[model samples]
Target: MTEKDFIPKRYSESMEHGSVSWEAPSNIALVKYWGKKEHQIPANPSVSFTLKNCRTITRLDFSKKENQSDFDFEIYFEGNKKEDFKPKIKTFFERIVQYVPFLKEYKFEIHSENTFPHSSGIASSASGMSALALCVMSLEKKLNPEMREGFFRKKASFLARLGSGSACRSIEGDLVVWGKHQETRGSSDLFGIKYPDEVHENFKNYQDTILLVDKGTKEVSSSVGHNLMHNHPFAEARFAQAHENLAKLKPVFAEGDLEKFIEIVENEALTLHSMMMSSRPYFILMKPNTLEIINKIWSFRKRTELPVCFTLDAGANVHVLYPEKDKVKVLEFIKNELVAYCENGHYICDSVGDGALKLK
Candidate 1:
């Protein structure tokens, strides 16, 4: 999609200096999306739990600037200037400038800080882009008082999707689904929608302990990995499997079937990496420690009769998921066994969150 497609009918008004801050959480995909289509649309539908604690808090300070044809903005990460992050933010503004025309008339000082460290195998894009989207949409609402709250969030999700596909899912809480599926209602390829509340409470308040297997950057970026799927021998079959699993998972979630939940979640995680390995130019994103953690998690679950499972993103870290009821046992296991495999024994304990927050 282009900027021309997002322009509102009215952009004749301008506002003075003001700042908006928002905190948006990262998400862990239970049904992984490995490929995409045009406009950053996912090739397959995916579901994820919105994570708390591991989030990005962003503040946008806007000031009236002299006549300028383009957006004038500076970005800071953790109080430090981030020249590297400017290109993506610049491109994102260019794509959505039509919707917020006053962006060109203002100079912005953006300060963003993540709760978790960068390149730690967490989905920073999901939190960062969603937080920015919330800030921009908050500014737009101030300019146009008639904008409804629901529309503001939907638009933010749409804008976030343009910046990063999975970022759209970060706009909602508890659980979210992106990409249209024949059986899912309200699902769209443009943006994500929160999962229905009909889901069992057992799935709510799920704990996720992110074991930092490797704190370094991913060997192959998610973008490059998605591109590789174009020539992957199993791409089509993988997409089909995702659809089938999502369908099965919906009922499993409503039925509160922990066994099925563990089955689907773990399978999805492994399938994601398997696709990467089977690609035309094969690569492995998982480290030896990642496998060790997974194996240990399996053994622990079998031995203790606890309902726990592991999922990985497009990186080497392990996300250990379990119900809130098992928190004590899970934490004890993580501290005793999993910590040994983690990088310097670092891990972020997080859980399902209530979506993004607008800071006062």
Candidate 2:
């Protein structure tokens, strides 16, 4: 899609002061986006489920500033000043300054908080950046009252991508697809598109219970990992495989094929880590307990014939996914068998959620 796809009108009136807030959810890719290019574009398409409960809420209070070219903002996280986050937010503001011209006229107070641990395997950047994007756009639409809803969301997603690639997907709820594809209409390398309505009802409300194996910060950052993929031997083949898997998984979503879903999701999870290990200066993000949890999940699945499956992000924590109908048994299994593997028996129970919410 081009700029014409979403048109925001130029407004003559400028708001002297405004405040906007939004809550955006994190997402886990079923078909992973492990590589990228310039401007945060994905090397291959990815599909993910929007997670509930695990989210970030961000509020921006803006007021007029005289002759300011750079960002003037103070940010707080969970009632504490986050001086460390200022640099990233500054970079984000610089990248998006052109698109949002009125930003120069404003000084901002940005307050943000997360529902889950920051670096413990969850995509904190995804939820954080998207929430901030939503708040910014919400304030923008106040200035330009003519901004349409589609334009508003697409613009927010586009801006979010500049901060974090997965953050674009967090702008929409349920299932979101990012990256260009021959079969997916309106899919873009610039922003995420919500999965089509062709999805089967059975896939709705899917459960994702995260087992926090280690709460410590990751050894290698996601940015460094993406950089490693640049010279990865399997880069070409891996990208191709992602396209193929995405094509295959669409039908599975529409048909509600749990068996195929398990296969595709599990493969995507492992493929993510495999690429990391294959990098020239490789690293391992998974802990010993990660494998142990996987084995137990598989063994339990085999014994009881349940549909439970596991997927991982860039860290050691395992997200155990299954359908809501099997919640009782799954929770029981987690309590009895999986809690031992998690750090301090810590885990989060979450499910599919409605995307970002604009606060009144």
Candidate 3:
């Protein structure tokens, strides 16, 4: 759908004060989205598995405001006031205010927390921004009771994209696709959509065990990394490669070709780092332990002939992806061989999930 389709008409109803809460899951991109354009449009089409256990829950309480000249909101993370986080939220509000115009009319209290540790290489922005966007959409739904369920979700994802690019994928399903691609029907750069094509049963309940190689914050943020791609020598080739890999994945996902899936996924992960490392002012986010864990996973997969593979976000941590049927053997290998590389031996076991949930 076009951007104009998401703009809402004048509301039929209004509330003086109310509260809304939602829990949104984190996602691991199989075909990663590394760069973007203005309005948070992605540089390439990407697909991801929505994660079950790593998530964020946000509750928004709003009251009618007497002074409505500016956006009014206070944000708390894990029950503690986080003044530093306000600017990001304010920027998000400003970006989406045109779409959800009631922002200035209400003073908001946003309480948010994550299931995974903050700064643990998890995409807290994906889950956190998505949860907050869902909460805001809930308020809009209340304001316009005539809004349809489908429209609500689409608009929520659109708003979430403004907060964080990857967040749009956290709004829906076991599999989600963001950005426009000829091969992926219904995909849009404006928002993420539940992958509409047939997915083989072999992928059902796929597992993702995250190994925390480093819990500290990164030296460079994802925004900076994406910006570097603007002048990157390989930027054009990488973007084209992502589309090619996504095309290759369609039949693989349909046929349940584990080997091809592994090839595409692992390549995408490494290529993401390659782009970062090759940039003019290059930097590395992967720690030494990250390589150690990857080698171990490769050895284990070679020895066991299992479908286990690894993917990385823009940080030192590694996400070990494998089919659900191999969970027992994979977890055993992870605990015994890979966990040693994790900081404090910390890891989280999670599986594919069906998107965000609204809480009463």
Note the residue pairs that clash in candidate 2: none
Arrange candidates by TM-score, highest first: which order? 3, 2, 1
TM-score for all models, in order of appearance: 0.96, 0.97, 0.99
Show where candidate 2 strays beyond 4 Å. Answer: 3-9
- Write one digit per residue (lDDT tens) for candidate 1, span 1-360: 333545677844468889999999999999999999877889999999999899999999998888787888899999899999999999888877767777798899999999988767676999999999999998888888887777777789999988998999999998999888887888888888888637898988999999999998887899999989887889999999999998998888888999999999999999999999998789999999999999999999999989999999999999999999999989999999889998888999999998999999
Show the colliding residue pairs in model 1.
Answer: none
Off by over 4 Å in 1: 1-6, 11-13
lDDT string for model 3 (113-139, tens) is 999888676769999999999999999
Scanning candidate 1 in windows of ten residues, the lowest lDDT window is: 1-10
- Candidate rank order under lDDT: 3, 2, 1
How many angstroms is residue 264 displaced in model 2 relative to the true structure, after the best TM-score fit?
0.4
Better lDDT candidate (1, 3): 3
- Pairs of residues at least 3 apart in sequence or in different chains that clash in candidate 3: none
